[model samples]
Target: MPTLTRRIRRTAATAVAVAVAAGSALTLTGTAPAHAHTGPRAATSSTVTSAQLTAGLYQSAYSERNRVLWATSAVGRPPVTRSSLLKVDPGTLQVQAAYTPPVTDAATGAVEAVYGIAVDDEHNTVWTTNTRNDTVAVYSQRDGRHLATLPGVAHAREIVVDERRNLAWASSFGDGTVVAFDTRTYKEKKRVTVAGTQPAGLALNERTGTVYAADLGGDRIVEVSPYAKEPRLIPTGDGPISVALSADGRTAYTADQAAGALSVVDLRKGAVTRTVPTGAGALSVAADRRSGNVLVANRAAGHVTVVDPRKGAVVETLATGANPNHVTIVRGTAFVMDKSAVGPERQDQAHRIRVGR
Candidate 1:
């Protein structure tokens, strides 16, 4: 999966070509995201010591009220066979529960290649993206019971649950769009056509009803709205693998893997305000809603930097195991998952670090 981030690093000329052919999909909206802010900010440094939370982990979905984490496990990369999901305790680092979703298609007997996982805590259900099968599944978050299956999302990457809207959204990298569905009945809602060959990640602001897609091929972040006829596409740094929007939905921080930096985008201005150097292989990003800190996983550098978006600076660095690509803060602890994630084995697993204030 290390090379997956490099799937769309094109020359500037090549990128422009893609944009022009697709009707301004790649049109550079703002200047390249700024790498620095106005004045000298306070130099803040913090490191988090960590320990293993257990194995059999992949993409993560967390529940604040339940204090549980739902991370997926796959046997194969695509069309994952014999895979399952584990419900984990963030505080104790113990697997509280586990559920193996049913094979989605009976004719092909296609096993769920669960990639992007999200939880609807309000309804006690879990939504998962079956990338291999081009489908999405919902199960009981309470007991792992199979609830329903919704088809039509192709090459699904990550999913976001909009609690406010009672809707779930999945990014279709292969199809070049984002699909939304009803959280309760698994009904099709809307499909947001976005730019890039790969929309590797998705971030949502439930309050604002704004969704941001990290367009890797197009090298930009596309602001998605259900009400708007056209999406707000803003170009950013190279190899944008993941995106995270601020609590206010005014700032969007994109993890640019090829550029090895974090692109800070001003949502309202539709421009990149700053580009902060994170480290090699800035793959995954998360915006801490409670603290307003942007957590980035530098996979090659083997550390997670807690970035202060307002100051455009990296304040804390959490040293962890190698190839730390995926990161999320669940219940006060920052759990970093490695891209080289293998089966339930602990030898190559990642450590969950306690994020400090």
Candidate 2:
């Protein structure tokens, strides 16, 4: 775990509050439908073929909506132009929109080093954790227009929104702190410190109003209750890089990148109930809410493991691009961020999976 230190010093005095535009759903705009399709739908009932299953895993729910897959190219030398939001159609697995972050001179002006990206589905906004600028950039998901650069966010890394409370929480790797901001106004409301060297990922169960954070260096998951007075630390596998929760909010899965395993934590017990062998370098984990399957993106192995959380076992493995890193599960699609070092820019490919019981 990296020490929480002041790595980025803010020099600008300007305060900016950008509001991402909430554009109309682009369901009928392109060749693909307008709405985004998620998870398994009623039309996919037959015994699916191998190709169909793979396509189903990646298919969009809203045939009316599209999934935007974004990749950060900072891992490349000379900082390759890799930060791009790739809008993919689940039906055809086709690229609909390729949005690239505008390049800026960090030496003179505000620039973003995006570590994580989250979709504000309700607002139709895309929020990004800008580590370099120490802010969250809100953009309109439909048209790729900048809404506002949220000021006052410190070392924003992994961010999650609690819809029930209408709040966003960002974990600060530099401060070992998690700060809560009002989603409607982007105002910091509270900050809590975690007993870890560095925190990696965060998940909020809107149903329970419970916040779970994977502390990478502490080898634990810090459970914070917005309704309670204090937070609790639950021991987990080594170096949990990412986390995801079941739709019902009873199960939480952690991807232990160092241990090369996936840790399934029972939310009720607040303890790890099972550890299943995934491929080496498990970087990200996502839950197929409809199927009760946990998907892991193993960076070093260039593959993904589909696990049955009930049995604590790996049920299937699918090959992916080189160095697959981040993952997000929306509806029926699992958008993979494959960061491959290729020349001045890193190549990121989005792969879909059909998740079925």
Error of 1 at 294 (Å): 1.1
Please give the CA lDDT of all the candidate structures.
0.71, 0.62
What digit string (tens of lDDT, one per residue) describes model 2 on residues 1-357?
A: 111111111211121111222331222111221112223232322111111111101111121122334333333223433344444444344445545565656554323545577666555666777766667766676887767677665667777866557677877777677778776787778888865457778888877778888888888888888777988887889999788888898878999999989999887787899999888999889897767888888889887777777887776666555677777665445656555433132234444444444
User: Which residues of candidate 1, in runs, are more than 4 Å off?
Assistant: 1-56, 104-110, 195-197, 330-332, 339-350
Backbone clashes in candidate 1 total 3
lDDT of 1 by residue, 1-357 (tens): 113212322221121111111111111112121222222432333334433433445677666545566777665453445677777655444456667778756765557766678888667788888877778889887788888878888888888888778789888889789888987778998887754457779898877777888999888887788778888888888999899887787788999999989999987788888899888999999887767878898888877777778888776666666777588765345666664433244422444554445
Model 2 Cα displacement at 63 (Å)?
12
Which candidate comes out best when scored by TM-score? 1
C-alpha displacement of 120 in model 1, angstroms? 0.7
* C-alpha TM-score for every candidate: 0.81, 0.75
TM-score of 1: 0.81
